[model samples]
Target chain A: MTPEILSPAFGLVFDPYVLWVVAGSALFGLFVGAIPGLSATMATALLVPATFFMPPIPAIASMVTATAMAIFAGDIPSCLLRMPGTPASAAYTDEAYALTKKGQGELSLGAGLVFSVIGGLFGTFILILCAPLLAEFALRFSSFEYFWLTLLGLSCAVFIASGDKLKGVISLLIGLLVATVGLDNPAGHPRFTFGLPELMGGAELIPIMVGMFAVSEVMRSSISVAAPLETAQTAIGNVFRGMWGLLKKYPLQTLRGSVLGTLVGALPGAGADIAAWMSYAMSKKFSKEPEKFGTGHIEGIVESGAANNSALAGAWIPAMVFGIPGDSITAIVIGVLYMKNLNPGPTLFVNNAASVYAVFLLFILANLLMLPFGWAAIKSFKQVLRLPRKALLPCILVFCILGAFAINNSVVGIAMMLAFGILAWLMEENGIPVAPAILGMVLGTLLEEHFITSMIKSDGNPLAFFDRPIAGTLAATMIALIVIPTLARLLVRKRPA
Target chain B: MKIGDTVLGALFALLGAIVLWHVRTFPVIPGQKFGAALFPGVIAAGLVVCGILLSVRGLRQADGGGRTIAFDEWARDPVVVVRFLSVPAGLLFYILTSNFLGFHIAASVAMLGWLLVFGVRLLPAVALAICFPALMHLAFYKLLRVPLPWGLLEKVVFPS
Candidate 1:
């Protein structure tokens, strides 16, 4: 359905209480996103329980608003400090930080905020128009199709681990292994529990995610004991002075980034980080001045930030329609929906059209809201860089603990967070990419279930994967991606160094 | 890269062997010939092949001065590793103590302990420890009604 048909449901979000919730959540998201170590996923997870008393529209509004704001807010830390506030922001961090060093921090933040809003709105527009069509197409995905989809996601681990593909594969395997810890799929017997009752349900994703990203970050920060960041002594001239110039300079770049971001975000298990990187790589490829990319270029910031933010809206497209989360943040949002007795899928659109429409509207409103909020946040958050590490670290630690505990109200979750934090640190030290590991954890169960189901339906014939046109195409894509990279490397090696 | 590849490869191989071994114990279904173990078995085989490839690559690269450990960096800052390790250790402790102290109290205590271990001062640590959990209590319990465990202090404070 078009956005015009969705207008009636948009009125539901205008309720006073819902607006308040949205604003409050947006502010909270800005705060978390501004923090160096805090992440949007953690913010969403912590806020999930807070939505229990609200109606579905308000709950979803709070999540969508907060996520949109948080995703943009991530650029604040990346611009002012070298550290990324969220994983999604990591792609643009180098360019943003370089610009910051050049006294163009405000310009970078401004561009990020403006382009992010544009990207987010564009994605929401696509979501509003294409969700139904995509949902219909998604319904065509049977067991074999799901297996290929999961395989495509698994192959992305290689793309992410471009420097060391083998280590990437291993990390992915570890994640899958971790997923197998709970009850056995077919027989319902425990596989790797080893008599631990707490593990019967396997490792909880929320705690593991928080531990891996947040706790591990906190630990890394503490050891290094970073010096207080120094902001530009002079004011960044006219936040919007060169906006028209930027649009003119990189029209094609921004459009490419937005499209790439939306597509990647729509893929289950691929989130904004991947989108940002893909966009950046593509932008570099098409740039007339690729050499200037890492040397404090506004195009890099605009491209990556816009792509990442748009990817957030794109993530919701698959999630709201197919009951599949595009990333960890969406996974938490899905959990919240389930808690509210709102099952997301084809039935959700038919039953709760208003709530879904409200979500779509919130995506636009959140981006519009960023115009003012992001401007003020950029100014104020720069002040936060002056806070001593000793003072700030403890506060972050408390938040991490509370965030972990709030997940299941179980200490086990907290413990899992800490364990995973340490494991993450060790993995990093050993040069293992944590992203692939997380991808494995997120996609493992889905892959296993679909694989077994497809196998059973085909009577153990693996060729069933090739029988479906769409599945075969996706599988072919995966094969091409793997083979083409190796073949290119071989060709390059054959040339004289 | 060498150390990373070898460790990852060996670990994968071991995990694959374990998975393959475990699958043999499951009873096979009659007509549905591809039982529960089929998926895991395929994954295990893939893991073994990948693992062997990785190990060979690792061994080949190990002799080229690429396998050196970061011993100097480790020695310079053992606190980094210790602090990193503390996160999981503290989490385990919190999990063990949550039922006894309740989720809130256990969470607060764990936060305080971690902050201290990470080298935060006592006053700020104590204040944050208390306030953070109290805020969470308000947010989760009072607002959302998720029902956090209150333990012995429940009767005196909440009285609900």
Candidate 2:
């Protein structure tokens, strides 16, 4: 990043129109994220249609700003209602809510707000430093290397991230199957279009994502519509009061959380939720007062709140450089990037250097803006709780409808949303993790394309996959990731027997 | 609804089998052994193996009293069931009607049904049903310039 790149990037992000978008999306993110059922992913999903009309910078800006705000705002509902507004907040919901019950809601909410900003900025700094370096390194990668890397990312999602390995693979296969629907493959043959013209373009990612993340959530929320929403604390006073003291007191925990959150977020198949869970566990393990964890303690809240928020930026690293999403949010973002002609790979860095830097600036600006916007959201949260889920849910559905329709200007998108909505709902009910399926859908075509190109280059010799040094190392790592774990499990089971 | 792993596994296996059989007919790329069928074929093979393993594990487990399917606790409540069903039904209703009724009418009617079904008061539901689509129109249509179908409203709003 030169001064020239930085200057133009600043111009792109600091434009009046772009700033307006960032501010509007900040509020939109807070509202959706503060609501118990609406997630940060849904915030991104619903914003996609609006972004369709935007240029690359503002479009990227809108998603970046919204998701960052949404991740922080999710802590609001976690503190007040014991219901996590997003999956990422679920890790520390109990701790935050316990504080609310103990009449220390201000402390928990304040720590969440402050630490989230720190963690987000920390992740963004790391992203700024590492992404360009990685992209430069990746510029030398061939089709063979890419084939292995994409496979490695997907394998990580299934083997390392998901709980039920068998079910995760099944979900991933379903996504891969879905990806083979259109004629966009190397062979130019449609696999499962069922003779529809719309199927020729392959399954649209936006509607399918809206269905999986948003519609499925609405379906789940609909069943509980009769259940009234009541906040544990009616009045929150001065959330910023004790935040500085807590930060000074636990600076090591703060740093550790931010580092771990970034690493976890950078990993494939895992996002903020996993990062929060892992960091919260790590915090407990390292804490002197581990017993105070679930009992109104603000320590876990501080660490994991930062973890989840920072994970948002961490997930963008692989997404920007490799076109491999770190989580479901970037899975959607990759599609948007492709749509905007800012294809997410090493070439994006070389060709769109200004845009890449613009994205970095947006991340920094978004995190800094979180303080005031999040403060306002916390103050006005009681009013948000009063909005009936019954009315609000239908309104969200209407938005989902418009969002889905705006993607293709066709009812087919809506139909796809409805179908996948039901499919995702069923998949979740069946204990199948939906994230791998999403990763599969996003990477499936790319994986196939690279594999075919590699095969053609090597003239059908499978051993050529491991001929390149980088590809060989990645292949070894992927194999060990799968084999070593299963082997250990088998050995342990045999010993027990 | 909760389905047994055995049943789910079988469904996946059946799906994989169907895909595997179907893809065999896809023509190969000239002078190359691999074709479009290769990727899907590999995935199908994986699905089959995973499905069988899942079924074996499910059968070994003694949960659910050996039942293949079970409704959730909330499934017992007719009202909750209706609420859950209404979501998909409403979205489907919009998909089928959006072109003819237009986005406004289709979306409003669907939202109205959802709000009412979810037990909001009649007046507020009616008001929201009417207002929300208009709000979306301004955002999606006016601001974003999405070519939202007018359906029946096309005649009245932009009569030639």
Candidate 3:
């Protein structure tokens, strides 16, 4: 808030080392995020070891640049091949792919890039203004509040389901079951290790994620391998061509997505993926032409693309302020912050005020860098899609394998990818939704942790969950989210169509 | 294969039952009212309810006598199945052979085999098969400091 603090932070962030790191990480994120099997989370995981060597400002800048670029780059594959590069992209992959198939590939790619920038910048502005206040609010939250918050985030799963609510619930339960497999469970006993030492650590998320989204895509592609590869547009020319026009027409959707994404991102457990899903669902729910959502509409893409990137910045609000991670990426960032001796919390703002400003400056710089970097990335996507499916699919397979193995430096991760890949393929082929299952996996552990800890704190008194004011409000909202929708549906059915 | 909701529901129910039964045996943490099984138990029960709902839907559709089992578009062709199975085979091949043949050789073979199986020409497949894994090896092993098992490459690339 002071010029003295801002002056030193400006010096720290503008250093040559930090700029280079941001540039390098932006490219790294683009490559990893554009690849079908790789994701933004994986980008950060791979960057962690390298970040350990850098100073705090450059270390955090690299992450900020990479994740922002990665989330946007994810849309490139989604638009081009119908394969989302990350789970966040999965929220709008169908919508983007639909546009590509409609011969509006350039528009699809542009919406993703432009809205991502708008959303990212918007989230940063909000973070700059609200982080200190939000952190103060978050600090008062106990396990009971967190339990409700996580539950509210988990409620997004039902909204995320594309079809068959029953199937969605089944898929979510499956994911929750997978989360219970490790020894880190509240009881301290591994529930489903099957006596294997590797299993005792529970499942690594990257493999499960890659398996469900990427490997399953591979399997799906393999079945149709003999079919001739057809593209909606053979060449992508000037992906930024129609972007300005689209932006002019849909300014409000962009704002709505950014706002929703930031709020969701500030929630402890929800991340960009949830933000995108929620935004997409919200876009559809409020759209005048909801029926056109899956048929290549750019409206949802504009919204969710904005969402996922903005959510990336929104996540930092909690991570920088309270040390409580807003998502998995920030969870890693929190560790990096601690390692750099910039321990998060309100004290850090006072004790290391300059460094906090350094982080903020890095965020602004990273979002600004996305313009050129994302432009180059869109151009590159066209070139990559030109490869024959036969050649390209194998290349993707190699990336998937390498990415899975690199995560834990173990073959067990690869095995998990294989097993879940087939399982996901079967589920998809059968009418079950895979996205909810993934959300369940991501939130399941947090849900359990919060629930158990709150129970322990409340000494198993069910009423104690509602003892706190925030907890009470959250519980009421969660109930309303479920009940109001059902009641409305019943009322609608009672009336004539 | 294209399966109906009935079978899918049964499978879900079966999975739920197995989870519920298995979690019952989990050691309850001493002096804690809720144990490790609490969350999983809740999930399993939810799965059971979903399975029941799915079964009811399936039964109603079946009673209409208009439903029929269907093969997916890909399943109608034997070659497609070959292409589909080749992916898993290629993955399993890499897992088994990566250490013995080395990451480079095994990955190249897997890539080459997958391309050929998927009907890529021999020359292009061979070229990509050899080139791709080397690039990956450099990035992961040399740059990232990940110790990718070299196997046969160890003797040549890192000889004593």
TM-score winner: 2
lDDT of model 3, residue B66: 18
In candidate 2, which residue pairs get closer than 3 Å at backbone N, Cα or C atoms, i.e. clash?
Answer: none
Candidate 1 Cα lDDT to native: 0.76
Consecutive 10-residue window with the lowest summed lDDT within model 3 chain A: A154-163
Clashing pairs in 3: none
For model 2, the stretches where C-alpha displacement exceeds 4 angstroms are: B64-66
CA deviation > 4 Å runs, candidate 3: A1-21, A24-116, A159-163, A223-363, A377-382, A495-497, B62-70, B152-160
Best by lDDT: 2
| CAPRI verdict (incorrect, acceptable, medium, high) for model 1 | acceptable
Q: For model 2, how many clashes? A: 0
lDDT of 2 by residue, B43-147 (tens): 999999898888888888876532389898999899999999999999988888888899889888999999999999999899999999999899889999999
Model 2, range A1-497, lDDT digits (tens) per residue?
68989999999999999999999999999999998889999999999988998999999999999999999999998999899999999999999999989899999999999999999999999999999999999998999999989999998889877889989999999999898889987789877888888889999999999999999999999988888878888878998997889999999999999999998898888999999999999999999999999998988888998888888999999999999999899999999999998999999999989999999999999999999999999999988878889999998899888888888788898899999999999999989999999999999999999998898899899999999899999999989998999899999999967
* Every candidate's chain B TM-score: 0.84, 0.96, 0.88
Write the candidate numbers in order of decreasing TM-score: 2, 1, 3
Residue B127 error, candidate 1, Å: 3.1
**Which consecutive 10 residues in model 2 chain A have the weakest lDDT in total?**
A184-193
Local lDDT at A415 for model 3:
83
